[model samples]
Target: GTYPLYDITASPLTSGTHKFDGPEKNNPYRVLGIDEKQNYARFRFSGERNKRKLNVEFLGIKGEKLGEWSISENDLKTPKQ
Candidate 1:
């Protein structure tokens, strides 16, 4: 919830603006689907537990890989998959 991770402009207590305005565009270091066996539902977004840069992959209803993504904290688009 800080800069570098959230690419948004901070609004100072001037110009009548009182808070930061803009959509949050940063992916939080994800956790899950991390290692093989998945052990907790392969390809499924079991959960975002760990706080570290890690890779993730989405799955379809039938358990098919849909796409891949890398979750990290930086001034980047939080890929809305």
Candidate 2:
């Protein structure tokens, strides 16, 4: 029972004179790709600046999420492919 594995990498944010562009809305991103481990999924968020987030879900063979871990922005160190 495994869903898939993947990674979400975002490009660097541009320099500006602001603490934050705006509140990071809990935007739902589409599943971009899967990893070889079959335990994670990648998603991309399109906003003012490019952003990416990874979701690790424990699947139940039929591809269902039983548990998950949301990746933080710091975890991404490179641009997604």
Candidate 3:
């Protein structure tokens, strides 16, 4: 499956909420806000039928990699109520 590549670090991100445009035009999943003080970030994913896993990387202020992880499709699925 082909996934759209996003250049998230095109501009310096501050320590607060933010909203930006995605790689695809008119994309709804466009929020990629990261709050350093709160140690959390928010982003939405557009479901891909053939995607089995997603890889995420965390970077510091100086562009150093803090950590990395992979999310399996199973873990991304909503649990049954």
Q: What's the TM for model 1?
A: 0.27
Q: What does the lDDT come to for candidate 1?
A: 0.35
| Candidate 3 residue 72 C-alpha distance from true site, Å | 1.4
User: lDDT per prediction?
Assistant: 0.35, 0.39, 0.48
The parts of candidate 1 lying over 4 Å away from their true place are: 1-51, 73-81
Candidate 3 runs further than 4 Å off: 1-12, 16-51, 78-81
Summarize candidate 3's per-residue lDDT along 4-49 as a digit string, tens digits. 4444432234556344345443556544343342232223354577
Worst lDDT window (10 residues) for model 2? 11-20
lDDT of 2 at 73: 50
TM-score of predicted structure 2 = 0.28
TM-scores of the models, in the order given: 0.27, 0.28, 0.35
Stronger candidate by TM-score (1 vs 2) = 2
- 66, model 3: CA deviation in Å? 0.4
- Assess the local accuracy of residue 81 in candidate 1 as a C-alpha lDDT between 0 and 100: 44
Error of 1 at 32 (Å): 18
- Most accurate candidate by lDDT: 3
* Model 1 weakest 10-residue run by lDDT: 32-41
